[model samples]
Target: MRGLGDHLTIGERIAFYRKRRGYTQEVPAGLVGRSTDWLAKAESGRRRPPRVDMLAELARVLRVPLGDLLGQSVLLEDDNQLDDVPAVVMR
Candidate 1:
């Protein structure tokens, strides 16, 4: 079985938490003073890593612990090595 911590790239993780908290891109974008398209780009991995402020706002909206967004978890049984990845981006 795939774990939630495994299958998620940074953008997908953001999108997952956003949806989980009932937030649409437009809504959080407005709250954070960003354009909806920019948020879309972030969520789709088309943009580079979001700025710190954006990440903070996203964390607030998603209600996730900040460490989760920062990818700080490491279960001994998990060998995925997903740690140290702050964000995912399309090149």
Candidate 2:
């Protein structure tokens, strides 16, 4: 499946990445220390997005950069390239 559009809400982004990575709700939910029902609600926009700390964990588990899930522009650089962009610290 295609990735989520730039205009999608956070909930949609989460669901999109989850599906793209071929993970069922139970898998990611458990990995992120959340219940499958909570994940379902979050994906459907029935619940608020995960907390910032949880967001990082989600990104790690989903194998996506945090910026992608957070709807921010991500800069990809090789090991030899130095990234000049300011880092966003999710607190």
Candidate that scores best on lDDT = 2
- Alpha-carbon shift of residue 22 in model 2 (angstroms): 0.9
The all-Cα superposition gives candidate 2 an RMSD in Å to the true structure of: 4.3
Report the Cα lDDT for candidate 2.
0.76
In model 2, the Cα lDDT at residue 86 comes to 33
Q: Clashes per prediction?
A: 0, 0
* Worst 10 contiguous positions by lDDT, candidate 1: 81-90
lDDT of 2 by residue, 6-86 (tens): 687666888888998899999999998899999999789787777766877888899877677777765657873424333
Residue by residue across 1-91, what tens digits does model 1's lDDT show?
Answer: 1256665556677787788778888887887788999889988978885765577677777776544665555233266433443443335
Pairs in clash, predicted candidate 2: none
Question: Against the true structure, what is each candidate's TM-score?
Answer: 0.69, 0.75
Q: Which stretches of candidate 1 lie over 4 Å from their true place?
A: 1-3, 73-91
Quantify how close model 1 is to the true structure by its C-alpha RMSD in Å. Answer: 6.5
Cα misplacement distance, residue 19 of candidate 1 (Å): 0.6
**In model 2, which runs have C-alpha deviations exceeding 4 angstroms?**
1-4, 74-91
